[model samples]
Target: MARELRGHDLQCAIAQAAAVIGDWWSLLIVREVTRGHHRFEELLAELGISRKVLAERLRHLTDHQVLERRPYQTGPERHEYVLTGTGRALAPVLISMQDWADRWLLADGSLTGTAEPDSAEAARVHALRGTPVPAPLLLPATLPPGDGRAPGAASRPLDVVADARATVLFAYPATGVPAPLPPSWGSLPGAVGCTLENRLFRDAEPSLTAEGVAVHGVSTQRPDEQETFAAGEGLTFPLLSDMDAQFAAALRLPTFRAGQTLRLKRLILVVDASRVIRDVIYPVLDIPAAVEEAGRMAMKVVEGP
Candidate 1:
């Protein structure tokens, strides 16, 4: 039986939340759901949990309103579990925990986003090559004003690159733009080349566009900050903000803390119109080379065999 928080503990948000999701199976269930595993069998296969335990956890989550069941099949009356608003709101918490584990437990407690080429982190990112990006994942975009669009608009990876043959989505730590970066930013490993990476992509935008390739940059920065930077830099492509870290959590992307916020590591993904990740470039050693490689991969995707 699960223990319930009461009295003074019930008044604390942390304690209350822990009481609901503190169980090991309960939290992993949420993580798996966020990763697009919806059906009972899918969760069971991914979690390797016993069927009886899985059923119990699913029922507990539904009773707590963290997860809701929707009928996915008729006649047989089968249902799939999905996150409720309360559960979806836990994205940041999951991402923060990942960041903590990556920094402290996995690595040497370094505050760097880039990883060694042969490192486990790099291997994990490389394994995403054949994975399908979730279609429903959308991030806020920093669009220019009066562009025939609303002031604050959200965009999905597929929708942004819908018209193009392929897309090069690059994730950077943060750019020193409308707002100044932390004083220690310059000294942090893998934190230096974001501005340059954006510039390189900006310079390559015209050619990439002509080749039916769309380019977009992503970071945890606010949309307004990205807007200011995009305008000032004369960037033709959009910069998406993962401010809530939903994108990070969905992909299990690596992150590090700086300036009191979680920032994505520098990496690139070549995604086709079908939302399949064709290639992944991590620990971006050279900014110029990575940009060139992105273009090459995008073109390769366009000129498929």
Candidate 2:
């Protein structure tokens, strides 16, 4: 149960927020739900929590408007828990915790975003191979002019991968386009290859399209910044701006702070047409090799079993 705060504690916003989600069980509940484990049994198996405890936590979260129950079946009257707007807003909190843990708990307390191939952060990313992406998740795209929509339009991952057999989605820190990168970007471990990665993908686009695969580049840069970069680079694909960190938080992607903002570490995801993550490439040691590997994995997914 959450602790009841008194007058002075009530005056602190942090205290109020913590009161709602300070419990270990409550925070784990939010994490599971954010990972798309909404059904009771799914949450139960994932969390390994007792039925009574799970029920109590779920009721507590729902009461606080963090989760809402929606009917998914009748007769027996089955329902699933989904995050409310308020709950969705907790993404940054979850991501911040993950970033902190990855940096301090898992690895040496370095400010770098990239990890070694054998690091715990790499293992966590590889474990996402079988995870299903949330169906309704969308990020604002930096579409080219005359696409029949206004600038900075939102694009769903499902829609982007719908017409293709597989889509190779790569995330980078940032690019030097309409604006210059942070001064320390060059010295950052994994931040050196954004422009190179984009160029490689741009050149590989035609062959990938021929193979029934699509490509998308994602970064924490704003839409205007991405738009300028896309045009200057003559990119053949879309550059989605996760300025709000929504996409990063949804996937729990590794991130590091740069220029007073969160930037995604270099990684790749090969998602199948069914919106399931088929393969994950993390700690991208070699930019060209990573792009080549993405193409290969995407083709393999297209080939099927």
Candidate 3:
């Protein structure tokens, strides 16, 4: 049996807000739509909401004028639920929810400029805080490419010097093909935001390369995983795989063990023609701004001191 939305008989503005979008399912539906998950199937797959509950919430939202039903297909008559202007105004409400939850629900340093975590992310964050690189200041030792083919390699063990005037080596933990996420992954702190950060850098590569600053995405994921991600994501920059931990050992890079594998903490290195570290951006908190800042720093190194 479908449960009816409870009626609220209050005159306060807050009550009115609750009347329209009080339920958890409604808010989640809106959040998914805002992220471009417009179709019914997309929302169902992403949210894991039951069909009956989803249909009920959609009807409620449409009735309240929070969302409008628009036809997308003609022959069989398919429709999509999109936010009305009134619904669009509720975005801040969701953002505020994330801010509040991150502050109170997560541990110190757990949010990492993103949302709160579940068990997997909690473990990752805990591991990250516990491990510290012995040497923070020094150039990482040069290491050979795990395979002959990297993201943008002309050849194996990509010659950092021959690649560009300077290279922005953006090191990340790992990348993979989308799969069934672990049960607690949705609650993982900064997990979604990390992917957003990678996309931001990938989009900025053309400009970075034009300015004589080559970009290379580095991760502990194997060569094949990096290749699949780079190709699928339309990334033009090379992606270096340090699966064996040889590169991390060479530089004593900060790392955390997720399972038996040690993953690189998020860090960006500006390496000049001499293979010397020119600048380092550690613990990247902001995505777009980080790439912009890296671009500014890269331009400086390319122009010479």
- When 2 and 3 are scored with lDDT, the better candidate is 2
Please give, for residues 144-259, the per-residue lDDT of candidate 3 as tens digits.
23544454544235432335788787777665453233344445443335466678887887887788888877766766566556667766666676665434543434454443
- lDDT tens readout by residue for model 1, 1-305: 25877799978988888888989999999998988889999999999999999999999999999999999899999999988999989999999998888778878887786888987788888988988777677777776445676544554332333457898999999998888889999888888989899999999989989989999789999888887888788888888988887788888898888899899999999999888899999989988999999999999999996
Model 1 Cα displacement at 207 (Å)?
1.8
Give per-model TM-scores: 0.93, 0.94, 0.48
- The global Cα lDDT (0 to 1) of model 2 is 0.86
What is the TM-score of candidate 1? 0.93
lDDT of 2 by residue, 236-284 (tens): 7888877766777777899998888888999999999888999999989
lDDT of each: 0.86, 0.86, 0.61
Residue 9, model 1, lDDT: 91
Residues forming the 10-long window of minimal summed lDDT in candidate 1: 154-163
- Ten-residue region with minimum lDDT total, candidate 2: 154-163
Error of 1 at 231 (Å): 0.7
Q: How many residue pairs clash in all the candidates, one count each?
A: 0, 0, 3
